[model samples]
Target: MRRGRRKFDDDEADFVKRGRIEPALSEDPDLPETGDRWSTWDNALHGPDPLPEWVRTEHGAVDTELGMLKTGKEADVYLVRRAVPDTDKVSLLAAKRYRDGDHRLFHRDAGYLEGRRVRRSREMRAMTNRTAFGKELIAGQWAAAEFDALSRLWRVGQEGGTISVPYPVQLIGTELMLEFIGDHKTGEAAPRLAAVRTDREGLEDLWRQMTEALSVLARTQIAHGDLSPYNTLVHEGRLVIIDMPQIVDLIANPQGAEFMARDVRNVANWFTARGLRVDQDELIERLSYEAGLL
Candidate 1:
């Protein structure tokens, strides 16, 4: 939890010093040491020989550490921190490292990725195609899209009541550095909304928060394509939305209204199960009205 400059032997001192603590080991002996050091394949993937000089110079100096926070089909999120040069301070952040080639799969699923606002046919087709260059382009676009959604959520949440959002910093290639959400000392995953067992009042409060998030998205002209309990975190009695790589511009897609309705319904259903009488239709209407969509 405490952040400080990593200690290195004299031989490794040639590498740039970033402030990050070594990850603690799990009980499993078969697992590799999940910490600040690089694995064999990591070195090969980003080795001095394969990496460009400029890339090495820029990203190399930016310190990184790897360990598991969450593993999904698209990427693995790791807690990463680096020192601000000329200062002893370290910034704690979350690093979402995408699996190489995931863009092709996401792009190919046009039905899933499509919104009410249509993308150009040629561009959509190109994104779906698994060409080398196309995949790279899609990868960059996906990261940027996620960052945009996170920023939108952060700004709106800060403005409207007691919601909180993880601060996103930068997206570098497949790596997205963001504000770390969980407790630092415990190294625990933030509690997802689905994992929490709450009373009726607490559930209603969560329902209100989720509805507010949907309204924020609608007002911002963005639709979180995947908004469910699993991607929502409950921290300190507040809701924090996460995993927004698929957020789409509502104006660009014709199905934006439908998607927003579904998002509202999903949260309503979850709360209903927790003994809260939630009217999905009413919630949807409320958000639409608040967003000036009605």
Candidate 2:
């Protein structure tokens, strides 16, 4: 019988040398190229993206990349599972690896990075020039930024306000490992709210939940900067916000009010389109007050 290649394997050489390549594993997960430039998306070899490593080395516990869930301008999200072959210790994790290398396609980085400060002039110049090192720096910066923001918000939610977020596991350079927010046993990812066709009941519930969660963000003096239905997940009737790399600084950024308004409007518009009666003006006003933007 003929066999096929090991799909989605991290590195070809390592697997081949160690006999880790499975010849019969043909049904590997699917990951399509998202046309993200080197220096910003995932799987750009000889690029700035950092490689993934097995943090824990157990005799039977092996980590596998199921497939890519989504790809954005800055990174890609892939489903990874770590489980011991014979035991019950198992977990599914979302691995978000930022892209790097070559000329990037997106140019709106500076807008989001307005309040962000770079320490060294050399690095700043390099970043402005979009040099290889600069792109790498940007990748790390975005990854670290998301990791930090998620950690802060995740803790706050855990402590009290109950923010729905994927638990940030650990980070290695431009790759962040997050707790998967779907079926643990089946490994089915929860669809984004944008993909769901909802009834009035579902819309109302989502609106309520989203408002509460955003209120926590406003109260904490932070804005989701790029909040939309696409970046949010509704799983088991709870809305979980994802993709935090662009989280705006409510107090630090000069355009905080504008960003906050945009965020509020995006959510409000979606809810209204779904036949939910939402007060955009009043909602923005209230959120601005909570965000200390007034």
Clashing pairs in model 2?
A: 38-100, 38-101, 39-99, 39-100, 39-101, 40-99, 40-100, 41-99
Q: Model 1: per-residue lDDT, tens digit, 220-270?
A: 777677677777777788788887777766666667677778877776787
Clash number for every model? 6, 8
Model 2 is weakest, by summed lDDT over 10 consecutive residues, at: 10-19
lDDT on C-alpha atoms for all candidate structures: 0.60, 0.70
Model 1 spans > 4 angstroms off: 1-66, 84-88, 102-108, 112-125
Write one digit per residue (lDDT tens) for candidate 2, span 1-294.
889753322211111121122221123244223211111122211111122242223434555666666556677677776665666656677878777755334457776776777999999988788789988888788888888788778777777855788777667677787878877766667777777787888888888888888889899888888888778887888889998888888888888788888988888888888788988889889988888777
Best by lDDT: 2
Q: Model 1: which residue pairs collide?
A: 116-253, 116-254, 116-255, 117-252, 117-253, 117-254
Looking at model 1, residue 130 earns an lDDT score of: 53
Give stretches of model 2 more than 4 Å off: 1-60
Candidate 1 positional error at 82, Å: 2.7
Please give the lDDT score at residue 32 for candidate 1.
30
